[model samples]
Target: MKLVVQVKLLPTPVQAAALAMTLRACNAAAEYTSRVAYERNVKSRNELQKLCYREIKERFGLSAQPAVRVVKKVVDAYTALHSGIRAGTLGGERSRRRVKAESKPIAFRASAAQPFDDRCLSWRHDASTVSIWTVAGRLKDIRFAGSADQLATLRAHRRGESDLLFRDGMWFLIATCEVPEPEVFEPTDWIGVDRGIVNLATTSDVDNFQGRRLRRHRRWHARKRAELQAKQTKSANRLLKKRARKEARHATCVNHRIANDIVAVAQRTGRGIALEELRGIRDRVRLHRHQRATQSSWPFHQLERHIAYKARRVGVPVLLVDARYTSQTCPRCKHTARSNRPTRDTFSCRRCGLAGPADVVAAVNIRDRARRAWALVNVPVSMAA
Candidate 1:
């Protein structure tokens, strides 16, 4: 498994300025290289490197590693562009009518990150600092800190390329790390989890993680954003962006907590988790104008991703099953109809007289579906015996 652990950097005034300059020069080099590649119709990385490698090195006054990184950044952009063209999304007869500009070159922002290889970056354990090669023609040591968990990963499992990121007047080093996957668990039983905007999650075991507080918070944020947007002032727009980041962070924290709780329940019961496959749900379902915003803001995908990862970390398997009629279908009598779900929260079966919370019924159905899926994939030991 690949994960990025962010470490906070504490750099002196001189070192910070040097780091900023390094990023500026590196991004400028990347932009120049990409523009040249696009104009010359350079497609492959080798072709791009052969064309602009020396030019960037001499023009930007950058060392070998940073110069190579700039070439790589531009090559990746061209690769992505080619991929989109092949996929019929860009620069083809199909897209020519839809998109007016086909020959536009890739552009990099001034604040784009500069990638670092192991040769250009090193960490000193004794001083809890990292030394990075900058545009100053020397390595600059910057103190860094992280949570104990993050520090442990850096000490044990850090791997691959790191990116130097500048955000909100702070510098951060994002290091990629590899973690060993947990052992696969044998199928003993399965638990269902229903996810919705009203109740963030509902389990077959009757546990509900309510989203009232979260909804209220999102509503408050929406109102504040609308007010700020209406003013159309520079400061208001800046505050709007800041609030967006803050809201996202807050929502992520809440999602982590909720996922932990759901995974804990599954682990305690010795059951694998079953969830409804909700991909493209937004495109499938239509809602009123006022309801669309609330529904769109639902972090269903984010919560599901968190739950799957947390479950995997603990050796608890998570399965996604078909969710077509899970909410309306009666789990008791197997009756299927739209009338069964008369209300958003209530499920009343017409044929079997079965009634319960709509989300819980869906959760039960999802659990059964997952059990059948597992049965097909693996024969139980008792049955084999």
Candidate 2:
């Protein structure tokens, strides 16, 4: 598993400026490498490296590792472009023409890549300090701080490349750490989880995680953003950006808690989690303007992702069940119809006397679907219930 830990650097003014200069120099070399690759039609990292390696060193006065990093960066950009063109996301004809006509190098801002094998980057856990190469030679013993959990994880499992990111007058070191994968479980039963805008999640066992508070918070943010947008001032723009970050952080915290609770329930019950395959749900269903905005703002995807990773991390399997008619289908009588759902929160079947919370019914259906699907694929009856 890949986990990222972001640590705030507490660098002196001199160290900060040196770091900034290093990042700028890295970007300069990258920009130059990109231009050279495009002009020479360099298609691979090896080709770009061979063509521009020596020139980059001479032009940017960078050591070998930084030059290689920037050259690899440009190669990766071209690789992404090629993949986009192949996938038909970027118009092949237009992309080809643009590539041929491209003259200016791409600009980078407030970011630098640090490869792990390079000698320029080192960390000292005891002092909470880092040593990094800069344009002004090397800056050593730059203090950094983060949460206790993050610091522990860094000390324990930090691996591979990291990025130096500058934002809002602060420098941060973003490191990726490796985590041990959870054991694969052969679940005896499946737990259904229904996700919605109103309630974050409802389980087949009648447990619910309400989203009303989050909805209100989102609406409040929307209004605040609109108010600031109307002012059209520089300070308003800054506030808007700050509010966005705050909202994201709040949502992420809520998602983490909800996911942990859901996974805990599943783990306690020795059941796998079944969820709706909500891909293209917005486009599949039509909604009014306000409803559309609310639905768009709903963090269903984020919640799903959190649940998935958390489940996997705890040896709980997660399945994506077919979402069609899960809400409208009657769990009691197997009756399915649009009329069965009389309200957003209430589900009642016209053919039968079945009635309950719409989200709960959906969760039950999802759970059953996963059970049937898993039963069909697996040979062991012990694994399915």
Candidate 3:
């Protein structure tokens, strides 16, 4: 599996200035390449490089490798844009977002991240420093810090390219690491996880990860954002962005904790994890005005991703089952009806008079479904035929 390890860089003022200048130059060169490609309708990396390489080097004071990286970045942006268009993720042909995207050449932010390969960037794991190429010159002995585990992973599995980025006056390098996955063991049972706005997650075993605290946290941030927007000043806008980032970090931390606990339980019990397939959920559900923000901003997908990666690392199988009727169907009586769920948190079966917490019932149904699905998937091929 491929993962990214990010480390914070501590640089002298002079080194920081050089890093900033280098990043700006790289992005400027990228913008120029994008414009040239847009005007000439060039998409191939080699062809675009041929057209912009010499000028990029001369104008941006970039060396051979940086210039090549700039051109490749432009090519990749176009490729991703075209891919999104083909995938209909941007919207339909006549949609305003799609048309707006197609109407202009792609632009790069001045502080956009730039990729550095081994030729331009070298790591000194023993000294906790890195030497990297900059437009001013080559910078050596720039210090970096990370957790012990992260540093270990970087030293052992770091490969391919690293991205240099500046965020909130801090410098970071995100390096890719390829780790080996353990062999999956036969599962003794399944743990079904039901995701919801109120509870966040509820497992078949009745373990609940509540969202009450997080909801309060978001409401506080929302109130602050509203106040900042009312001010409508440049400083207010900047502060708003800072607050948004802080909120995002908090949410990510919560998700990580929840995922770690769930994966740990699954591994300890020799159980696979089952989750609902929630693709395009936003399109399928209708929401009231007050509920839209809560529904849209919830990090349900992030929690799922964390669970998946952690499970994979520990050799726990994950199953994705259909999400429809999970909340409405009765697990005990097998009765399916909307009336079975009389409220958000309660479930009462219409036919057999079964009752339980809605989230737990849904989770139980998910576990049952996974058992049946896994059996069919792993059945011997020639048993009858």
Best by lDDT: 3
Q: Count clashing pairs, candidate 2.
A: 0
For residues 1-385, what per-residue lDDT tens digits would candidate 3 score against the true structure? Answer: 9999999999999999999999999999999999999999998999999999999999999999999999988999999999999999999999999999888899999999999999999999999999999999999999999999999999999999999999999999999999999999899889999999899999999999999998999999999999999999999999999999999999999999999999999999999999999998889888899999898897889999999999998899999999999999988778899999999999999999999999999999999999999998888989725
lDDT assessment of candidate 2? 0.85
**Where is model 3 poorest over a 10-residue stretch in terms of lDDT?**
376-385
TM-score of each: 0.91, 0.88, 0.96
Instruction: List the global CA lDDT of all models.
Output: 0.86, 0.85, 0.95
Local lDDT at 304 for model 2: 93
| Worst window of 10 by summed lDDT in candidate 2 | 109-118
- Comparing candidate 2 with candidate 3, which one achieves the higher TM-score? 3
The digit string of per-residue lDDT tens for model 2 on 25-120 reads 788788777777767777788878998899888887888887887777777777876676577664556576555534345455436553433376
In model 1, the runs with Cα more than 4 Å from the true position are 84-101, 379-385
Give the residue spans of candidate 3 off by over 4 A: none
